[model samples]
Target: MRKRVAVIGGGIAGLAAAVRLRDLTPPDTEIIVYEQSGALGGKLRTGELGGVTVERGAESFLMTGADGAESAAVALVKRLGLGDAIRHPARVPAALAFGGRLAPMPGGTLVGVPGDLAQLGDVAHADAERDHDAGRPLLAEGEDVAVGALVRERYGDEVVDRLVDPMLGGVYAGRADGLSLQVTMPQLARTARVEHTLRDAVRAAQRAGRRVPGKPIFGAVEGGMSRLVGAAAAASSARISLGLPVREIARTAHGWRLLLGPVPAPQTDDVDAVVLAVPASPAARLLSGVAPAAAAALGALDYASVALVGLALPPGTPLPDLSGFLVPPSEGTLVKAATFVTTKWSLPGDGPVIVRASLGRAGEQERLQFDDAVLLERAMSDLGALLGGELPPPVASWVQRWGGGLPQYAPGHLDRLAAARAALPPGLALAGAAFDGIGIPVCIASGERAAEDVSKAWEG
Candidate 1:
């Protein structure tokens, strides 16, 4: 029988899997990709602004390679012929924006939760007025309730509310209180529960010779994340039908048959293997019959809504010197985080600056109350106050709303994933930010790992 593989969804995860399957399988093997949307980039989309570039979803990938993310990004760039269309540095600076000022993230701080309990306490120190008590140690308050609980337990309520919540707003876009610190922040959560103090864990980790990343910042191609996905799509051998949405999946004698949608004609494509690369909810619906247990788990993983409001302001504006600011969940607003785009990128020329404020994190709490117009008004007003002055209105504005934007990693997320994988059919596989990781590199690594496992299974 001819070996054929069907990859569902056309986003980066699916795209990466298809590309990997093409390389691993023999020349006679067949691979076909199905996407619900007309586009193949998934969460990655880009647009133009007076010849300048703007992104609606992801902006960059954290580069940790000695040669830089160049190699990882090379696949897509070469595939899409966009090698020269963009430039991404090896590193970018990260800062906390508060009181209209940017402060370098404390040194030796990893995700604002140090491995050492003492360091963790220092990092959690709140603004003088907020703390009220000078030199008061900020230990998390919660006792094994959830991620929010754990952070509050070790770092204190102030730290959890102000810094951790805001920074995580960008990562999870969900209420920190509900997040399972274990699932969302494995290292810190583990340290808090298992180890006596973060410092003890660090010493143990050092003895074991484990190291973590330094800076927690990421940036992308000048054009946008689409540049990377477009390149990946080009490199794959699969026949990509953009706009061709998959309606159903039926188990077959050899493998499976993917039913096409939007205008179902009962058309089905048979394949020896399949890879579903879409988000959790969509995949769950498609696989309700194929893998009930896995589907149920997928459905259980809650995904929250998100919106990005990109502002293009006039030049010569007296804006506050800031790289970005994270709004704590305590703010009780729709906005979880905001980044000073033009300042962060240091894009040449000052012709109107660019600032992107996040309006909805896991569905706007306060920020979401108002429509785009109201949100924009309040955001600009805040910006003006923070930037030091109320500047002219924006030359252009783009409000990018994601219905199911980011996945919430409740506690037990890792264990649940392991169970889902074990429950999946031996020939079936899962790969994407939804399960194991959420970053670009993590997704790439996930695709590669899934491919290796799938290849091994087929060989075995």
Candidate 2:
């Protein structure tokens, strides 16, 4: 019998799932991808600013995973024949905007948690005495805690607010107080399970994650992130159904049926297996009847909205030699992070100095409700303040807003997701940023895992 798989949500995760299904199943297996939006690559959109290719969504991904192996994203790029297009950032240090001045980010820190307490120079004060052994491990087996709560308990408020929060905000658009250690810093969390002190745990985690010397930590496609999305989609060879919403999914004796399109006139798709790769809310809605527990867990997840402001300053505009800087929420600025795109990447024939600023943090939705012009103004203002000089008006500018774009992985997020996955029925699996941790590599691995799960169910 010819097998068929339906992949809901045509983002990177869904497309990656489709590609994996194609690789695993027989050549005759049919894979179809349905995307609610008119486009693919949910948070990997790329745009042109002043004739320069720039990413409107995620700009880059970690080059290697914690084990010092090539990241899943790099592996996918190789599989898709885009290995040559990989571009590493220039070896410029990042800074933290503190008290209206840029301070070099401290060294030997795991996501802003100083592995060596003595290395935390000027960025933030750590209470070294409080980091002494408590005669027990920092975390109990299978227990989860917020990254901020754990750090604050040992290092004090300065460490969490000044160092950790901004670093986390740059990636998750979430505060450290709310994000889960297991979900965000799994390596550190694992070490904390056995290590008696927070500093010791950080040291152990850092030692475990020691990468190859002189290798760049981050990478991006030469063209843009869109190239990655396009390659993955083409390689998947799945029937593309754009701008259609999958209304409901119901299990059938033979397999599964999906109710898609509008309620007035719907379409049905029957498949041997299905991959739910959408965001938490919609995934919850579709799974409510079939997997109530999973639905409830999915519904409990929260998201953060953010806007990216890209500017193309005239060539010869003086900017810092650094790649970028992150701003602590205590700085009271609309801009949380900014990247010097052209300075960071070796773009060919760059006509203008490209800069991208990220605005808005978790639980600050109202601050991002402004129009593009207003948001751009606020971002430019913040940049000027950070740079300590008024920047010249850009020759070209762009603003991209992503509402609920980032998932806030609360404490126990991984446990909740595990239980949700366990409760799901056979022939159905979930993938994407919501189920797994965020980031391109994580999402890609998640999609591939879902593909494997459904393939096994079909084989059975």
Among all windows of 10 consecutive residues in model 1, the one with the lowest summed lDDT is 129-138
User: What's model 1's overall lDDT?
Assistant: 0.67
Against the unseen true structure, what C-alpha lDDT does each candidate score?
0.67, 0.93
Tell me the lDDT of model 1 at 289.
89
Question: How many residue pairs clash in model 1?
Answer: 27
Residue 8, model 1, lDDT: 82
Candidate No. with top TM-score = 2
TM-score of 1: 0.84
lDDT per residue for candidate 2 within 1-460, as digits (tens), equals 9999999998888988999998999999999999988999989999999999899999899989867799999999999999999989999889999999898999889999998878888878888898889799999999999999999999999999999999999999999999999999999999999999998999999889988799988998878899999999999899999999999999899889999999999999988899999999999999998899999988999999999999999887888888999999999999999999888885543489999999999999999998999998999889998999999999999999999999999999998999999999999999999988898999999999999999999788
Q: Model 1: residues >4 Å from true position, as ranges?
A: 65-107, 114-145, 189-194, 202-219, 363-371
TM-scores for every candidate against the unseen true structure: 0.84, 0.99
In lDDT terms, which candidate is top? 2
Model 1, position 165, has a per-residue lDDT of 70
lDDT of 1 by residue, 1-460 (tens): 5677778878788888877887787877777878878888878888655345777887877544322344344454445566555554334455554545445555444445444444433335633232232332223434334656655655567666656676677777876777776556545544444455444443443434333455333447666787677767767778887777788888887678888865636567887777878788877887798888888887888777777888887776555556676655654545556776777777765566777877676645444655778878877776565445775888888777777768887766777788778888856788887887677666766665676677667677
Clashes of each: 27, 0
Model 2 scores a C-alpha lDDT of 0.93
Q: On a 0 to 1 TM-score scale, where does candidate 2 land against the true structure?
A: 0.99
